[model samples]
Target: MWQFLKTWYHRLASPKWFYHTSGRWLPYLAAVTILLLVSGAIWGLGFAPEDARQGNSYRIIYIHVPVSVLALVGYYLMAVAGAIALIWKIKLADMVMVSAAPLGAVLTFLALLTGSIWGKPTWGTYWEWDARITSMLVLLFLYLGVLALSRAFTSRDTAYKACAILSLVGTVNIPIIYKSVDWWYTLHQPATIKLTGGSTIHPAMFKPLLVMIIGFYCFYALVLILNTRAEILRREQRSAWVRELI
Candidate 1:
């Protein structure tokens, strides 16, 4: 079992192996991503019943909630990849970290944008300096900082190390973002979904949300894999395997 695990990790850490392996899976992933996203979007936005309170405006939850969840989860993935690159000096991990930055930034931006839109009706304002919203804004800047620092250094190793440390340091904000609504009185509502206790949401509404969340997760993985593949090809352009594939 240990040997099998080690072999799997070794293959995963290998750029050439990942490049070839990902190619075979990309088509299937793309198909699944498209199908789920389309179905979930249509179901959630068009078919799901309106909320008792928020009415049609609440429909934005279909996109807002899913992207907000993805944004936080993506930040964690970015931080973990950065930590792996720094701790193990893994080139593949570094590539994953770099590729994750911009994608995470976009997701964060979407989260903020959609949240602001959702807030207009619910909170009677489009913008608020509440703890949750402010911390989320900081999260966006953290992602952008990683992107900026990566390009600031001429030395690749220096850039990777810098981004790694920045990502790790920025992780402090994640918990702050998660707990901001609880830590202080804020316009943002407390979480409807809970891990331990049963969810506050009705199952009828939650089912389409579940589908959207799953579809969003698949979409995130699809983007990450494609981005990492592009980064790998560019970084490994001079390698024999990359040359042969080209």
Candidate 2:
């Protein structure tokens, strides 16, 4: 079993293998992303009960929470890829790290945007320098910083090392973002989903939230696969395999 798992890891570590395999997965992932997103949107927006206080405005959580969660998760992916590239000197890992940065930034932006939209009605303001939101904004800048650092260098190797170090260093803020509401007085509420206990949301609402989260994950995977594939093609354009395919 260990041998088989090791072999599988080696295969996945190859960019050519990953590119070809991901082509086969693209269709299936796209279908699942569409199905789950459409179903979750309908269920969360139309069927879920309105909040007693926030009312219809609470429906934004379906979009806001998922994007926000994935934004944080996406940063971790970039950091991990950067770490792998640094440790192994894997070109493929560097590509993955670079590909993930823009997406992470975009997700962070959406989270902040949706959160702002949700906030206007709930907090009587469009923007606030609250702890959670401030940390999240910092998260966006971190992603952008990785991206800018990558391009700033003319040498690809130098860029990879710099981005990897920056990504690893920036991870300090993630815990800060997670603990911000608990540590500080803020309008942003603590997480409804808990690690030690069941979620605080009602069953009716929780089910759709769960579905939306799953949908967002599927969507993120699909986008990442596509992004990686594009990067592979661009970087390997002169290679025989890419040339043959082209």
Candidate 3:
């Protein structure tokens, strides 16, 4: 099992292998992403029961929660890729780290946008310095910081090292973001979906939420693969294989 894992790790670390394999995955991934997103949207927004308290406005959770969850998850992915690149000296890992930064930033912005839209109805205001929201704002900056650092240097190695360091250092904020609501007195609601004690949401609502979460994950994966493949092509443009393919 260890040998199997090691062999696959080496295979995946190869940019050419990932580029070819992920190309095969793209069509099926795009199809599944579209199907899941459309079905989940119709189920959550159109068919699910309205919130007794927040009413129809709460339906935004179908979009908000999934993006919010994935924004945090994306940061983890970026940081891990950075770590791998720094330690293993894998060019593919650097490509993945770079690809994830902008995507995570976009998702974080969407989470904040939808949260604000949801807030006006529930919190009587669109913007607040609530712990969760503020931490998420900080997260956006962290992602932006990584993006900025990644491009600041003319040398790719320098940029990768700088971005890797920033990503690793910035990870301290992730835990703060996760525990903010629990640790503070804030208007932001506690997580509705819990892994340990079971979700607090009604089954009808939970089902669609679950579907949306999975759909968002698929979407994230699809985009990451597409972005990484593009990065591989750009970086490998001078290689014999890339030259031949082009």
Candidate 4:
């Protein structure tokens, strides 16, 4: 079993092999993402019960919470990809990191926008300088910085290294974003649904929240796969495999 696993791992380390394997999963992931997102949106927006405090306005949580969560996760993914590219000199890893940046930025922007919309009704204001919100804004800027720096250099190698370093440095902001509410006084509420401890939200709201979270993950997977495939094609355009596939 160990030998077989090691062989498979080595195969996956090859860009051509990884591309072919990813191709097999792409359609399925895309389909599942669409299905889950549509279903979750319909259920959450139309069928879910209104919040006791915020009423119908809280329905935005379906979008806001999911995007917010994905923004953080996406950054970590980009950072890990950057590290792998820098340490192992994997060209594909660098491509993945580069491809992930724009998507992460979009997600972060959506989170901030939706949060602002949600806030107007709940907090009686469109924006606040709360720690979590401020940290997320910083995260958005970090993502932009990585993207900008990656393209700033004429040499792809130099650009990749610079972006990787930026990603690693930006990772510090993620923890600050997560712990902002806990570590400091802030208007943003504490986590309502605790995975290990206890949940403050009732089961009715919790169910849709879970569904939306799953839907968001599926959406991210779908987008990442598409973006990564495009990156591979762009970077490997002159390669025999890409030529043959194209």
Candidate 5:
């Protein structure tokens, strides 16, 4: 078992091996992602009950909650991939980290936009400098910084190293973003979906929210795999395998 695990781990460290493995999983991941997203969207948009307070506007939770969660998870993933790339000099790891950045930025933007939309109906305003919201904005900026820094250097090796360091440094912002609501009194409500305290939200609303979160996670995996594959192709363009495949 140990030998098997080590072999698999070492295999993944190779760009070609990682590319082929990811390719095998891509179709399955994509199919599941689409299935979950469509199912969740239909359920959330069509069947979920209207909020007693916010009415139809609360329906945006389907997109808002999932994207917000992904913003944090995505950053962590990029940082971890960066760490792996730096430590092992694994081309696949660097590619995964690079591919993750734009997607993370987009998710952060969606979260902020949807939050604004949800806010107008509930808070009677489209924007506020609340702790949660402010921290989220900062998180978005961090994503941009990593993306920019990664492309700034003339040498790819130097670029990857610089981006890796920046990614590690930026990880500090994630905890700040997560705990901002707890540390500061904010207009944004405390977690409605708590594990131990019992969810403040009704079960009807909660169900679709869970489904949507899962769907969004699946979607991220799908995109990440596809993007990683593309990066592999580009990086290995000179290789016999890539040339033959192309």
Candidate 6:
């Protein structure tokens, strides 16, 4: 099993191997992503019981929570990819890192946007400089910084190195973001979904939320694979395999 796993890891590090393999999996992945997102949206928005306090306005949690969770997760993935590229000098890792930056930025933006929308009703304000909100805003800027650095250099290697260093440095903020509400007085609510202690949300609402989270995971993976494939092609355009595949 270890041998098989090691072999697959090496295979996954290969650009041509990933491009062809991911292409075959795209259709099935897209199908599952669409199914989960649509069903989860319908269930959460239309069928789930209303929040006693916020009423139907709470329905936005279906989108807000999932994207928020994945935005954090995506940054972790990006930083890990950057680390791998920097340490192992893996070209495919650089591709994955580059592909993840914009997607993470967009997801972070959506999380902030949805949080603002949710806040107006709950907090009586559209925005606040509270700890959680402020930290999340910093997260968005970190993503933007990585994106900008990735494009700032003329040499691809230099750009990748710069982005990788920035990504690694930015990871320090993630834990702060997670713990912001706990560490300070904040309007942003403490996490209701706990991995170790189980969730505080009612089962009726939590069920669709769980589905939406899973759906967002799939969506993130689908988009990442698609973006990485494009990046692989762009970087490998002069290679014989890419030319023939094209």
TM-score of each: 0.97, 0.97, 0.98, 0.95, 0.96, 0.97
Q: For residues 1-246, what per-residue lDDT tens digits would candidate 4 score against the true structure? A: 999999986786677887888999988888888888888888888988888778899899889889999999999999999999999898888988998899999999999999999899889998999999999999999999999998899999999999999999999999899888889877998877766898888787778778889988988888887888887787788999988985
Q: RMSD in angstroms, candidate 5? A: 1.3
Error in Å for residue 136 of model 4: 0.3
Worst lDDT 10-window in candidate 6: 181-190
Pairs of residues clashing in candidate 5: none
**Tens digits of lDDT, candidate 6, 56-130:** 989999999999999999999999999999999999999999999999999999999999999998989999999
Model 6 stretches with alpha carbons more than 4 Å out: 1-6
lDDT of 5 by residue, 62-108 (tens): 99999999999999999999999999898888999999998999999
Give per-residue lDDT, candidate 3, residue 112. Answer: 100
Off by over 4 Å in 5: none
Q: After superposition, how far is residue 37 of candidate 1 from its true place, in Å?
A: 1.4
Candidate 5 displacement at residue 202 in angstroms: 1.5
Ranking by lDDT: 3, 6, 2, 1, 4, 5
Q: What digit string (tens of lDDT, one per residue) describes model 3 on residues 1-246? A: 999999999999999999989888899999999999999999998999999999999999999999999999999999999999999999999999999999999999999999999999898999999999999999999999999998899999899999999999989999999889899967999888887897789999989988999999999999999999899999999999888886
Candidate 3: pairs in clash: none
Residue 171 in candidate 4 has what lDDT? 98
CA lDDT scores, all candidates in order = 0.90, 0.92, 0.95, 0.89, 0.89, 0.94
Clashes of 4: 0
RMSD of candidate 3 to the truth, in angstroms, is 1.0
Q: After aligning candidate 5 to the native by TM-score, how far in Å is the CA of 19 from where it should be? A: 2.0
Q: Is candidate 2 or candidate 5 better by TM-score?
A: 2
- Compute the lDDT of residue 76 as modeled in candidate 2: 90
Off by over 4 Å in 2: 1-3
Q: List the residue pairs that clash in candidate 6.
A: none
Candidate 2 residue lDDT tens string, 1-246: 999999997888888999999999899999998999999999999999999989999999999999988998888999999999999888889999999899999999999999999999999999999999999999999999999999999999899999999999999999999889899977998888887887778889989888999999999989988898899998888889888785
* Candidate 3 colliding pairs, count: 0
Better of 1 and 5 by lDDT: 1
